[model samples]
Target: MSALTETDPTGAGFSPEGLARIAPWMDRLVDEGRLAGLSVTVARRGRVAFARACGQADLARATPFTLDTVTRIYSMTKPLTSVAVMQLYEQGLFQLDDPVSRVLPEFAEMRVAVGGNRAKLETEPARRAITVRDLLTHTAGLTYGFMEATLVDAQYREHGVDYLAREGTLAEMTARVAKLPLLAQPGSAWNYSVATDVLGQFVAALSGRPFADYLREAVIGPLGMIDTDFFVRPELMPRFCATYAYDRARQLRLFDDSVETAFAKPPAIASGGGGLVSTAADYQRFCRMILNRGTLDGTRLLGRKTVELMLSNHLPGDLAAMGTPRFAETSYTGIGFGLGFSVMLDPARAQILGTPGEVAWGGLASTAFWIDPAEDLSVVLMTQLVPSSALPIRRELRVLTYAALAD
Candidate 1:
């Protein structure tokens, strides 16, 4: 029941007592059987402020984890990809509305899925070619590895579309993806998907560099996010936490050892949407950059205007196109879908109680983080818990964490 505290890196007013509020919940996740290992960090005004780790790196012993322990950040990579694309945006690499075909040309004539037998499927020109903005906003009418039940899914499988493998290049991924039909027309509906992966290819095509190299130089390098990358170096392997999934019996258990060398080096397919590993401390560097409005410390990754554009919700009404809003019970009712994360505008409508303008996103592995510029607060809760089972934990953690700010 003891409180954990750390000094704020900026010597700001952010106090350890703020983090003390969530100490019990973090402990209970281990004590009550919801998680095997986890790390939580809350920083305000450029400082660590609070950090804690509990349970064993593995299930065997309750040995504490370290800041270096890497966790699969799954979709958290979206924000990074968003930043990369936005970096190009700031440089005038491509206007947001430019047709995606302008860069890759592969998706210029893509088809849309109309359901039913593959043999009798209808084919037509995409209402509009996918745009650069579409890729950033998840409205590119694309699908993910887990979506679809027909030829498209089989194509994904046959193409060996492993987002984590260190073999296929971004161009190769685009060619494979282009062959598959889109589930919707560009900018017509929202579907959380492989759009960012396409953006990765976009980065390669426009920058004339590999997606991983572009991200490293354009995003990670400038932000000093050293621990965030496609692969965890061999020396850092011990800190790479084992990923867990719902077992056949519906229990949490370790799955694979970092998805087949993904954490070792840049995979051939750079999944801008979902394929990256990072540590809590490392990811803070990225979040802190966003919270700072495109600048952190002194280095600036985006213009303030561009940051505003990135954080603002881009989805139109008729939310039917996008997949069901995830984690509504977390009080996200007034929240609307943005290009990369969820945007909270009317806390009342979203039935969520956070400050307005609070934006957030989570990875499939239950990793979640958000920045509330209004409150000058940032929260990151990391765990290997399955996405579904961890919902209660995330809601409780957010409510409890925000409640402490009431002080």
Candidate 2:
């Protein structure tokens, strides 16, 4: 809805000729029917160097995508939820190493799965309780049912451990998650899991406010991310893009209708993991806050040191060293999981054009964002496709975006 296409990026340290390539690239993607609709915004040194949208928000309606087009950001919500929890950490509400059970009694004592099938599970006492940092780092041994690679993941499916089930509140579902056998011992490994959803419950219990409310007041509101939320309000529905998936024929097909989407209303459980709909404009601001060391427009949601800690690598080594055999939101090579984002350790090792210490993440929908501290850059690239692995757009855009840098 806002006319935000970049008017001039030369002043922002980008070559005009290089920036010119983006429009045709987007046009090619749209014209070839690779994307139904897409929007991208790139900012460096707090100035937008390139911002544009192409394709249709709704193939049926021919709605144009724009900066305000709302998208299901999915796992991108993890960073925001992680930031919210760290706000309490800054208050000394709890130590990062403190057991999660200190706030949610459901995880007080837990068992780890050594081996077994989905029909029966073998377990032993966990080496230690899952700590708050474990949840933040995704080392608490939880597994997403969707991974379907291990018995614990199957158990998650069997017991409905997903936040999408709409069975109860964040607290109620997280308690169920605690009852399940952990895929591994706490701090023993990293697996993409429902750790962030549990972190949502932890925030609610310690802050004495609902997870969604606290997230808004402490993080989203302060950043002025008005259009970023777990649900899209009625007034904003018109700009909400329809989600898509590749059919067996490899053609785009409607996945989630914009008008009938569950995100059109509040969710039963606030999924801090893979929830929240946002626009390129709103998410860019979120990335900018992180790029700006936890402050945006004079609103400080977290201390600078806390953000530094978050952006720093937390794993013992790169993700490939973790030996996690599960489908993840990020590549497990030359990348390390930070508190809330994937820290790029080496561009050469990762085989991607990126700077070390770049914090980034993507969603179930082929949406992605990254904040490169070395380059003073933040970018949000949005499209409505499901299963991000469906395309190599993120990597392609990264090359295009970084190539335009003149300073």
Name the top lDDT candidate. 2
Per-residue lDDT tens digits for candidate 1, residues 234-301, read: 87776777666666675667665543544666566767878888888778777788888898768989
Q: What are the runs in model 2 whose C-alpha is more than 4 Å off?
A: 1-7
lDDT of 2 by residue, 1-407 (tens): 12346757888889988988888988888898888989888888778888889899999888998777989999999999999999999999999989889888879889999987766789999989899989999899998998878888888888878897655778889989999999888988888889999999999998999999999888888888888888999999999999899899888999999898888888888899987898888888888888888888877888899999999999999888875645536788899989999999998998988999898999999899999998888888989998888888888899899899898
lDDT of each: 0.72, 0.88
Candidate 1 lDDT at 284 equals: 79
Listed per candidate, the RMSD to the true structure in angstroms reads: 3.7, 1.5
Tell how far residue 200 is off in model 2, in angstroms.
Answer: 0.3
